[model samples]
Target chain A: MAAPPGPESIALLERFVAALKAQGVVTEEEIAEQIARTDRASPEIGARMVARAWTDPAYRELLLRDGSAAAEQMGVSMAGAPPLGVLEDTDTLHHLVVCTLCSCYPRMVLGYPPHWYKSAAYRARAVRDPRGVLAEWGTVLPDGMELRVVDSTADYRWMVLPQRPAGTEGWDETRLASLVTRDALVGVTLPMVAERAAA
Target chain B: MQDDAPPPATHDLGGAPRFRCTPVEPDDAAPPDAFGKRVDALRQLLARKGLMSVDELRRGVEAIPEAEYHALGYYERWLRSISGIMVEKGVVPAEALKP
Candidate 1:
């Protein structure tokens, strides 16, 4: 079993969790479970969404316009919470999403979030310097992509359906799915390889 | 089994037979009781003089978990709470924000 959090952090999180409840963010069990379900890999479900957006133009455009609606096109539903929307990253403006205030994720699509995701460090840093945050995640932005950070709050929520990187023109859906990294889906990480190499 | 659902009246004004939120208050403002519930405790503390609007602050309540927002085991309970608060607070509009 993993070690438990220190008392100071737990106390803070408890108060944090309680505050979120008052704002109508997340609940006790959901918070507990979300904290419990922390993992290294991003949700396989979000990866599938990224893959679908890659080869399908209609789907990609749809995802950019209405994420929740577009997700439904691929069988992922954000119906549990409020009307959630999806946001996409383009060449001129790269989009990165964070609750800033809380961890209001598309829980249905991304599954439970990581512990770091909801951390005050992340919340404060993400808004302050997205490029720095991405760098910490090991993503070095390309020469000319302007990074725009968006705070996903109670009013609006977002998901990043990153553009298919320059490679693997003929790759099938299964092959494409592997290329979609968790970071790419969340907008913090990127698909490093041009295409899925000979793996 | 698909037919198992609470009656529509028990739900929101949408009349779609969804889950219900905890009866905390008039539902116009963020309920004070949510403070002790879950993630909301923090938000309740941080909601300073002009940090945020009632709508934004209310959706911030979503920072909390679902059970405190709506009746447990009621599918779409979370949706009701988030959308309901936003709608009631005029953040998204009644028709557009209806859960």
Candidate 2:
């Protein structure tokens, strides 16, 4: 766990906020609203979209063609965020996302970026040795499969539409979404079907 | 010609060879702590008010010295960037930041 901010740091932040309020630069309600909006965003939003895409062909097409529209279709607000691009992963090809410059994530869909995503090691190796980096996460792709590394930039954010796991043909959207982890959306891992019990 | 190209900024780490040997930590899905959330809220508020843009914040983050960039936490870097931009834009005077 990271250490809490030092007293001096906390004091400075408090003073800064107070000064901003005094100058009518920002109000407490506005700050609280922003926090609430941010808190509402999570990996589940992306997972729901992925699940819908898997079940609805038209929605899938929309998601592939216009990610921002697809996200809004699912009740996610993408008002001020940069355009979102969904990378479709297939059996023959896989996509991995990295913000090589900084952590430019699809926050409106996937919430804030994972801590490791912001690390220098991840930012550096993700583009150079993607397979090796994925290997560290135990996501080993087949030798014949092509691994595509995409850099999510300031102007555009990217998310992965991971291939649906097999043995889930009859699964409902909720059940399918349960299998879609944030790692899968980021293309670091694949969603797997849970084993069933014998009848 | 390759030698004439400017060195990449410290924040520009895409495909950099120096970090090849660095080991990535395991995934931790924990949300930002309270302090981080507050810092993020401040940034969002600033952006909403047209006081700053995401690109300006990124530029401020990129401008940090290499060592300090590595040492600071994620939201701490954001706080620095947001605060710097506020001062740069004359939205909040530098004196207000000092406790």
Question: Which candidate number maximizes TM-score?
Answer: 2
Residue-level lDDT for A55 in candidate 2: 98
- Candidate 1 Cα RMSD after full superposition onto the native fold (Å): 17.0
Q: What is the C-alpha RMSD of each candidate to the true structure, in Å?
A: 17.0, 2.2
Clashes of 2: 0
Per-residue CA lDDT of model 1 for B5-87, tens digit only, reads 66422211221212122121111111112212232322232233233343555343444454443332111222334344444
* Model 2: residue A2 alpha-carbon error in angstroms: 4.7
Q: Supply candidate 2's per-residue lDDT for A77.
A: 79
Give per-model TM-scores.
0.55, 0.94
Model 1 misplaced regions, further than 4 Å = A1-42, A194-199, B1-99
Provide the lDDT at A97 for model 2.
Answer: 93
TM-score of chain B of 1: 0.26
Name the best candidate (by DockQ). Answer: 2
